[model samples]
Target: MKNLLILSLLYITLQANAQGLNERVIKLTDQLDSIGVATFEANYSHGLRTEYIVTVSCELYDDSPAPIKYQDQQGNILSVTPEQDKRIRDLWRRSHESYDLIRSTSRLLAEEGTECYIWESHRNGIDSLLYSVALRDFTNQQDKTYMPDLSTNPEWSKYGGAKEGFILKANPSRFLPNNDMEAYKKNRFQPKSEISFTYRLTVEEEDEDTVYYVDYKEFAGMIDKVLQTDGVKSHPILITHDKGAKVEDFKSEIISCDITHPDLDGETHGTVYEIETAELANTLRRLLSAEIGNYVDRHRNLNYLYRPLQDYSGDMRGMFSSNNWVIRTEFHTKHWYTFDKNLSCRVLLHHVGSKAYVLVLESVNDFWLPKDWHKLKSWKNGVKEYLYLQL
Candidate 1:
């Protein structure tokens, strides 16, 4: 009777845990939907205009310590590192600044131009826009900005993996009209948006964050400071979290998931399923493997960056493949996946298990293959069949 009762209890507990995880999965999905995504096109709202406009928001604080030094130095002032100077200036703007600033230097941009939006830090986790200015040439005497007015896809329209690109200074892209070539050639620039920004940011003085209201001159300075400083800028003002997603649900043994694929890119977004149980984590890995195996079969065009991902230089997809193992939060191994052996666009399943975090990096087309290769063939020789999804 005791054993039977214990077994019954275990069954009931497992059922309840599953029910909770399902709820958490739903909440994660809701959070993604609520936080939303930002997308913009040249024809979209306020992307371009004939008028010169500038907007600013600076709130005066009634409480907190009176404004102190924007840059606090102890020993020799010259000894202060650039990073330290930035921290001091940033804190002052958040805590001390009283005035508001706004300016519109737009003149020749009426036809086509780039606009820069300035955002400033605020108190209690609040950040407000310092101002926005339009540039006629996307370049002025001091700085150069990339204009999207003439381009089909501008910075404003970027979402997901699309945001991390480079702003290359080159001749007009193929998207530009042949007639406009002469004009575009006179002043040439291109954009390469990318995934990672300067990783040099330090959060040492994060506690000093406060709100700043700005004046036109101060607003201009704020813009210049962000452009010049490496790690001074905070998160974008427009990005905000609506409600918190409960983490408890995903940590349960039920293998809750909150994953999304923007589809425009070959990557997945927001995998926040937290697993505490080792057994549960293993099960989740199997589930992920199965799902990914299915995904690869359907999406044969997928590519991996490097082949023989492990140094062994052999078939890595095999289970017993000798990839180096390291101990961390959990047992982990990374393998590269691709349609063919060519290195272009590929997905890397990093690599995770207990506290597992799966990362799907960018993919590229197999450019090395012969041009006459058939798309539907199992292999180049039409002999062996592709078994990617069967895994």
Candidate 2:
């Protein structure tokens, strides 16, 4: 009697929430008498003739989340015994298995290729009978668990990227290496073959299909305009790991590519911009001078300042080379670029193929150049080796 009353109360609660939806959807609920759960949606159209459509769904399987507990005579809560725990675990697993079986049942029905029974309903009640269930194009739709298609432009399929998902243009073209994330982080400056602007498709959720790229023309314009500067030789090529999928479940077009330079080793020569003008030389001189002056000013009072040029010691280290018109720098790395950190410069003018003076600051803890110290050591060394005028 006590157990019967408890079951009766549970039935009332289930009926209020689901109204026999579980029994209607599943044919073999006899074994699931204790813990089955279900939900449903219904539609009704009424006039002299009535029409209705009903869709039912079952809850996902879960491990036993709330096991039965008891209140002791002293009012403290107590856990179930070992035997009861075992039974609860079994019951929970059964519910989970049942839910999974129901989900796969639709796939099984498709394979069977025929309907055992077909029923339709009207406003009054289920009355009309229909035959045949059309199979969805699972290959094209990919996954139907989530909603798809919120595209504003119908012609988005012609361009690269998705047609209905999220896509953003990286202004400076930052590529995240998706093929191997670890390797990418370690050697991210690998040279890229393609020099064109890239538009990457991004996914917000797993089920979202067809990501689209807007403002493709606008972004293209930004990348090309930078090259119009005088004596601008080249721009940095980008290569990254990207998880962005394209709209080519059918056919995809490669929108961007770089023409490889046969002689250039991309790893050491990975720079974002290239300047070939005399202005490039001038700018390097001014920047170095300013930074060196700041460093000497800061550490002039230090007792053990190892002035390389003993005669030009004190606050005149940076000043000695400021008057010179020529400055030498590494051909490959002078143009190299990284995301944020400073580039390593080498003292070499052989690649420049012209009269040039190089700067190499071997060690300057006493100076404040950050990493701006060029490779040229002293002005005197410029007169000795690779000298092209000490100024």
Candidate 3:
């Protein structure tokens, strides 16, 4: 009778949470529409009896060509320059025309479920955005049998300290090595390539928060073995963790090294190391900077900060046009054409401790299109690389 009562109470709690989620989705949709979103689609389904999954997509209206007076540093309308209008139009012509698709699927499981989202623009290429969210059920009011054990799994074991909290996992495929150099050279444009990889990590709950860590070195070593036979470039690596965690709780460092012809462009070369508490942030920052530097020359753009994995709805909205003029706005921020013009390629780095992964999310593909072709091509060529040092 006691167990029956407990189960009934748990059902009520889950129902309430699901209803709350529905409300949240409604609000989110409204927010997108207010920002000039034109089309939106979503799906919600039950995973297990107590778990669910939600997916969302929105097509935003673009207003890049709207004319406005230029403002000076003092916030004064310095002049009504038509130059801005022309610039906006030029950008629209060169800009890829396609839907900016972002897909985020959330899974609410027992113990603490996981939610992740990927944001990628069709104009940017087929590569999608990837992010994750984790939750913890503290009430013990949920199902008693639903508790997740982190010790048995090697991935969960790394994050033993986060046993009580939730650990969100991002996609590791975003940071693999690129293997399409020859295709790019032949086409003089970015080549679209598919990426596939497996991720196995552990999470532990601690106090009120969940602490999750990955043995990047081990993962990198695995990648090294796979790429040893191929001519892979020494691209910088990237691994993403949740946004809220304090860096002080983690440590990371390169502890070992190996090389088989380090001078070769695609030769396997790197160091192996560990990341413990406190050093997570600094190490991540350094690794990201190096990775970004390879694509965007640091000497050319000092303002470049590590790119965070953001949802697509926030960035790739539709382009707005009037009287043969078009403008592109990302997340409501007007990006200067110079940024794209100067861009050699857009790379996504997925960092996992001392071992990092790098992938070319998008690259220049101007020469691939026919001169007279009116329509834009949706795919391009790029490679994802996994790196680790031999101990």
How well is each residue in 1-391 modelled by candidate 1, as lDDT tens digits?
2333334323322433443322322332243234331111000001111111111222222223343223223423245666775565454344222121111111111112244443343433222222222322233333244334424634333211121111211121343354253443332221111111110001011222221111223322322332232222112111011123222422342121221211111211111122343443343333333333333223222221111111122222331212211100100011222122111221222213223222221112111111111111222211223222334
What would the TM-score be for candidate 1 when compared with the true structure?
0.17
Model 3 residue runs over 4 Å out of place are 1-23, 26-67, 71-213, 223-231, 235-391
In model 2, state the lDDT of residue 346.
19
What would the C-alpha RMSD of candidate 2 be, to one decimal place? 30.3
Q: Estimate, for each residue in 1-391, the C-alpha lDDT of model 3 and write its tens digit.
A: 2333334323322543544444433443354445443322211111111122222332222224545445564667655457766664443322222112112212222223432222334432334322222333223433434434333533333222221221233221222325333433332223232221111111111132221111234434433343333223343323222223222323222111121222222211222222222234233323333332222221221222222111222211111111101000011012322222211122223334333333322111111111111111121111222233223
**How well does model 3 score by local distance difference test?**
0.27
Q: Which candidate, 1 or 3, would have the higher lDDT against the true structure?
A: 3
What lDDT does the true structure give each of the candidates?
0.24, 0.27, 0.27
Q: Candidate 2, residues 97-200: lDDT per residue as tens digits?
A: 55444434433533442211122233221112222222221122333332223243221122212211111111111343433434433332321111111111
All candidates' TM-scores? Answer: 0.17, 0.18, 0.20
Answer with 2 or 3, whichever has the higher TM-score.
Answer: 3
Alpha carbon deviation, residue 290, candidate 1 (Å): 19
Name the weakest run of 10 consecutive residues (lDDT summed) in model 1. 38-47
Q: What is the lDDT for 154 in model 3?
A: 33
